[model samples]
Target: MNREKLMKMAGAVRTGGKGSMRRKKKAVHKTTTTDDKRLQSTLKRIGVNAIPAIEEVNIFKDDIVIQFLNPKVQASIAANTWVVSGSPQTKKLQDLLPGIINQLGPDNLDNLRRLAEQFQKQAPGEVATQEDDDEVPELVAGETFEAAANEAPSS
Candidate 1:
């Protein structure tokens, strides 16, 4: 009857049933605040103590890329990049999110300060206020607060 049917009849292809043979569609995801929390949790679980991306929450098209500085298991400081498709206010990227998050390392104070700088970009209609965090943060992978602080620029 049709090209696919002909192939199937010839045993050149494997059909699921006697009826339709089209593949099932994948589920589409919609981004949510829970997704953000999940992402944060995943990063935390993977030993990625600090996400160094302090840049504006820039979302263009359907992609979000964040870079954080963390110490590797080998005791070295490096920049880690995470590329996420979609946003809490935009699209949802579900399928690949979990696998991407599993690859995380550690954090530092300089990384946090750099990250904190980005909070200045207020969302539309959001009131701005300053609340300082003088306390040192919890360091992962045995990294010290002083080590992270040394990476920050003296104010």
Candidate 2:
């Protein structure tokens, strides 16, 4: 009888069913794009002037660690470091992601937009306009624009 039980236990382990065993798996995520109009309409339903940063597209990652400039977020994470893992649906992990996000405060979207505008302004040459396109003659040569500009006189 003891031998029979031992054989059954060995069989179970070989067949991949053992007590308290967890199968190793990698995390998977889905991504999607939404039109701004649809997004703002959804936010309107929630009575908030703006949507939360973490909810926006391209947010959240597993391999990357992000820091926030906001004091509230900086203080919260200062004490909490252990990650909640195992599964995305696991209540512990699910709860932790949002808490981390909130503590970090709003995503740096505003700062990002400001920086983008700054870069656009600093970009070389005058901003392209439809009027400018009309003012400039169509390309007559196969040479690149820079080559053509070099051949032409400076204003």
Candidate 3:
């Protein structure tokens, strides 16, 4: 070995015989359940006062109800269908909506539009023609969706 190679090998032995460089990382932690709770509440608002039709069924293995404004359109969550009617016949939204677009034979576009139009008539100004920012408000600090929902008086 040359003089320079001998000196380099000797230096490596003096420093624990390691051959690679690395960086050290610091650990970090966060606590932000507040934002998640806020978003869930906002989705739970909106309207169902004048829905066109509603379907009641067991979904996700739970006795839930799915309200329909049109064939596949829903205005309220499944479990809250009773909010509109005290006693609705057991039915499924799947019973009305075609399983596939092809099943309609590509000739139900007008029927679909008419269904939507009828829904609009039932609930004027309730459709998506305007934004619903005013309908859902932001949650205050230290507040949860369940707490806010429980506090609201049932209509």
Candidate 4:
């Protein structure tokens, strides 16, 4: 072939042939709009600032507790807004007893043990039951007060 034809062939080979002339398709990612993202952006505009030196966050909802360890916390006191972002672990009150006891320290535990012993001694075979209207009813684990009230016998 001619010099020009040879050069063209050489160029095609260098550029990985005719297939390389076509543009490669880009990867398409489907993006979804979420309420969380909107709320975050709004909060940012409102001057919400990150809270520093926060170790942990605990939110109690009735008998359930939501715990976050080493989480990002943001607050805007003027706006009365607080935001905590982290992987949450939900635990019942019974499950958190050990941690609560440890936090109470040995001194408080001893005092609590003494109080329990005294109470037991005072009422050996008698279980305490509330009769007054002001008294709160005993609730089972995972049972809400409203649910317990509904299950209770109507007077």
Candidate 5:
């Protein structure tokens, strides 16, 4: 009877091991929508009004670098959050922004331009545009906003 019980326990353990190994690995889809509600609300509070289609909010050991569709807008939010009187320790927070902005390569630039266009259409008064400026940047013939954004990634 003792030998039969030991054999049954071993078989059960083996069966469970096989089941655990069969579990599927989930795909990691990076987007801002998955961020915590408080973080999202804070971003909205600072005038980063558009929903970022693509975002990389990496929390390093010492700093949290949030890369979103619009680096400029994200920078503005950081400024507003950090520069206010009686605000919390912002020096470290401020340190992360420049590096984060520097990483806005070609793919991110295009994303920002697309986000800017959407914001322009949704909130005309709030979003800035080259067309709205007194002095617009010159573009060669057959050039476009998308093309300019797609030209080269920033360092």
Candidate 6:
């Protein structure tokens, strides 16, 4: 019995134990949506080719920056369409201000300080009111303004 048990143990060790006969689970891939498929087909027909070897892409907004590392880019000059696909990291301009200031060095820093001081010294009453300006600004092409009644209330 002891000899038989030893042989069984050695066989189990060689064969990676009891569950080794079970097949590994298949990896599930993401299925593209109908819209994605349609867009890809349309792009192919329109001659929108992939722009390769793009290291990074940055999009700047009023107060934030969107960064994509190793993004895939595609563009068609005729269609005037550009597409960027990647995981984006959003960083606030406020968060980046310190780094920018450090890069500007001491001379620029002094000028910035002086400007800030001047701004602070100005009286609130002296600030320009909307009625004080007579110049009418020209509207840009394809620009439209929302009615004040339709605007959402700020918190």
Q: Could you say which candidate leads in lDDT? A: 4
Q: Tell me model 6's lDDT, rounded to 2 decimals.
A: 0.77
lDDT of 2 by residue, 40-149 (tens): 56544544432133322222454243333221111124333322212122133334555554544355655545545855875567566677657755564687879977
Ten-residue region with minimum lDDT total, candidate 2: 67-76
| TM-score, cand. 4 vs. native | 0.45
Q: For model 1, what is the alpha-carbon lDDT of residue 91? A: 32
lDDT of 6 by residue, 63-132 (tens): 6978788999999999999999999999996686675566566888998687567557767568755674
TM-score of 6: 0.43
Off by over 4 Å in 2: 1-78, 82-107, 124-155
Which runs in model 3 stand beyond 4 Å of their true positions? 1-91, 94-100, 124-155
lDDT of 1 at 88: 34
Model 1 lDDT tens row, 35-119: 8899667665554543344432323343343322231222113335444332234334344345434442345445545544655
Q: What is the TM-score of each candidate against the true structure?
A: 0.17, 0.16, 0.18, 0.45, 0.20, 0.43
Per-residue alpha-carbon lDDT of candidate 4 for residues 5-118, written as tens digits (9 for 90 to 100): 997765754536554664456898755667778888999998899998887887868569899999999999989989999999999966885776766778889986876675
Per-residue lDDT tens digits for candidate 5, residues 59-107, read 3343343333222223355445521211122235457656665777998
7, model 6: CA deviation in Å? 58
C-alpha lDDT score of every prediction, in listed order: 0.49, 0.46, 0.51, 0.79, 0.54, 0.77
Q: What pairs collide in candidate 4?
A: none
Clashing pairs in model 3, backbone N/Cα/C closer than 3 A: 65-78
Deviating ranges (above 4 Å) for candidate 4: 1-30, 33-36, 101-155
What's the lDDT of the predicted structure labeled candidate 2?
0.46
Of the candidates numbered 1 and 4, which has the greater lDDT value? 4
Best by TM-score: 4
Per-prediction backbone clash count:
2, 1, 1, 0, 0, 0
- Total clashes, candidate 4? 0
